[model samples]
Target: MWSLWGLLLCEALLPIVVISVQVLSKVGDTVLLVAECPPGFQVREAIWRSLWPSEELLATLFRGSLETLYHSRFLGRVQLHSNLSLELGPLKTGDSGNFSVLMVDTGGQTWTQTLNLKVYGAVPKPMVQVFTAATEEAQPPNTCQIFLSCWAPNMSDITYSWRREGTINVDVELHSLFSNGQVLSVSLGLGDKDVAYTCIASNPVSWDMATVIPWESCHHESASGKASYKDVLLVVIPISLFLILAGLFGAWHHGPCSGTNYLSVPDDF
Candidate 1:
């Protein structure tokens, strides 16, 4: 049977044995791994190691000193703090994996902790492009088929989602060609001119969005380089009124309305 004092001591030490920590970081960013020491425990030396994707020794730190020696792939990108914590910066995808740290206390007791790091690239600004599908001719009268594609240039590991008017989800009846929401197929009628959609591109680290109106895009494409009758009227009406006013001004200045007397008084009078 275990005594009460022994059980209490075991309970206090249980939390520090083989601890695991998780860290999240983005590409070109920095992350810190803390070496948590138990209360009243004095560390004499600390050794940090990378344990996954081919094991390698990282760095070592000594107590009471701010200097540390880094090795292998962590030469210029790593720093060890005075309290046995590690700081790594300007991170890359290759830096993701399991890391471990071992600390030997002044009494020769060892403590170990494991850290799991995950790195992700920031999601770029997405662009939504609209196209009028060739199947419009086969569709019902006064209806159009529009195809929309969303993309983030030079980015990967991203998922796409769509919303209408920036709030509501896309209708269930609409067809989505890709499971990742990269392409959307929309069928619109004449009454759906006000419909608009936004595409959101996201990754674990960041997200971006772009918006497009399928009807407006398709209409603009069909009307390219051709002026509407209403637009022509707006331009012609203004110019016609200006021309009429200019003609009246010219007649008043140069016609019989001029102040010059046509007949001269007789010299004899």
Candidate 2:
């Protein structure tokens, strides 16, 4: 009867539970995750696991001591802290997942919580891309509009923004609904030909920027490959000079006057 009464009393009192989240870690870095417990409830044991790639055991702790790290992949890479929190070092893309913590308190009360880990490469230098253009004849001077997009490869959840630099007073209108005007589809005047626009790509961890001048972006590739008159003249002039000098040297060395020697004149007093 006493044992039954003690079991009932134990069931009535449950340890308070706390869960933590929003842990962000970059690739090739360490991330610390804590499984917190309320006061009066001592952490007796804990088990860390994941369901992101089916069932997998990460590590375990007993009485604040590391009991085992069951997964071979995490054998040398995992550390169990005194508070039963887990520290994963040198993170990789494969480390992203939904992880769970199963904690048992001293009173035999158990608590569970899950967190999502996202690991990604640092943001790359963004590239600004131009999509369309209009000539001055088609539109009024400085009324030519172009579309621009900022791209950072392999990055997710990025926030994009666009701003113009220069005194052309160009209009940049952001798309209202979706990306909050990250992409610019606007027009600029002929007087704005030298103006540059910058695109910014950002996330919770980092940001990158790229700049573009609309008037030059379209012709950038084509103009680079074509030879100019100045280049042709530079090549032709040097070769022409070499040929002329060679002809003069040959005439001096082998011409009619080459072998002719003047008769010696007697010295007159």
Candidate 3:
């Protein structure tokens, strides 16, 4: 019984040098890999290597030095930090791999750790497109409702969301209402008060948003209101002036101080 337990323990402890790490990155960005060492032990040497996509030796360093000797393709893009960490960057999609580091302690014992890196491209701002049945539906409508779609060009691994007035809630999807991850439709009759729509696009590296409204149509409404006011003034002003002139003429003809005796010399002339 003890023999089986001992064999299991030896097998489990053997090749246990690997400590795996996971990370996500974008192109033209940096990724760092770290090796943890127990305190009070001086590192005599350190070596970083890539295991997946090919076994390539990437770097080696000695104590009391700052520079890391790197592979030919990795030159000028890798650096060593004080805490026994390696930084590789302005990354590329091909840089995704399993990175390992081996350390030699003061007494010359060897140990290692590994990292798994995954890379993606950065996402740009989303462009929102809206559609409606009404003519000139380009703008948001106070009378009707619409459909909206968001597009993030030249990007992958993206997700989408819809919002209104900067608030997110279950009601955002409930007003005669419904929304897909990237598309949405709503109606004004629902009394939803969602004056505007916003689309948010996201990826592992970044996220952005765009908003739309029908204010141009509202602008036309304001102009119409101003035109109506001008029309009312045009009619009312002439009518008011005519009334004033007629009143003056009637008073001159019928008032107590009429034309008969006000200027007595006019009859002699």
Candidate 4:
């Protein structure tokens, strides 16, 4: 009998624990927070309130009628579904906080749940700029040093990562190019082609990416090709000048048999 009394006393003083749920949302997006209760707990009334930024009662739903009353800043932007879930929409950064739903069953048992909302703005598109590092005349043969810097302007709390789609060979390891935080330093060969690199900017809510091909922007011409072009210009210029001079000489002196002029100046007179 003493054991039974002690067990009853322990049950009477048991503390209620509210379950916490985490939620992520982007700005200008709608989110639904469902009020979860026990399966057999017939809820007679449920009250939803904001617990952060300031404590305020947002809405209440009764059993018989499906009516809901909104409060404060959530007047037109909050709605209730048939399942006692709250639909909050077009969320702003200020809407990030804790919300609680209290459900009272018909037998007077109360269940509370807290939803932690984290609202973040979508990540902006990253811009990548490539810079060529100047090298001395005594530098390594066929080596081109470059730096690719990735950034998103006017953004805070953003993460940056990189993705390389092509290969780089400088007699060095591939991981050596990634030591400079958001700036990737790569030593590529002059003949390297199709080397594309992408920069990824991300937040908890969204991500954006930008790609750049450094090889294509730094184009090269072969020494043999340049020499051949110079040789062609040298052979063509003199020939062109000679043809122009011959045309002028032919216009100035005409053959005697061509007979467009008569030089019989008064000889018969």
Query: Which candidate has the highest TM-score of all?
Result: 4
Error of 2 at 215 (Å): 3.8
lDDT of 3 by residue, 6-115 (tens): 32343346443456788788889887777786666577666677788888766666545555664545678888887779888989878888887777665655567788
Off by over 4 Å in 1: 1-16, 37-41, 136-138, 166-177, 220-269
Error of 1 at 71 (Å): 2.9
Residue 94: error of model 1 in Å? 2.7
Name the candidate that leads on lDDT: 1
Scored by lDDT, model 4 comes in at: 0.73
- Residue pairs with backbone overlap in model 4: none
Better of 2 and 4 by lDDT: 4
lDDT of 3: 0.68
Give the clash count for each candidate.
0, 3, 1, 0
Compared with the true structure, model 2 gives a TM-score of: 0.64
Better of 3 and 4 by TM-score: 4
Model 4 regions more than 4 Å off: 1-15, 66-68, 136-139, 167-181, 216-269
Candidates in order have lDDT scores of 0.75, 0.68, 0.68, 0.73
Which residue pairs collide, candidate 1? none
Work out the TM-score per prediction. 0.66, 0.64, 0.61, 0.68
What digit string (tens of lDDT, one per residue) describes model 1 on residues 24-113?
889899899998977887876667778887576666655355444545676789888777788888898788899988776667566788
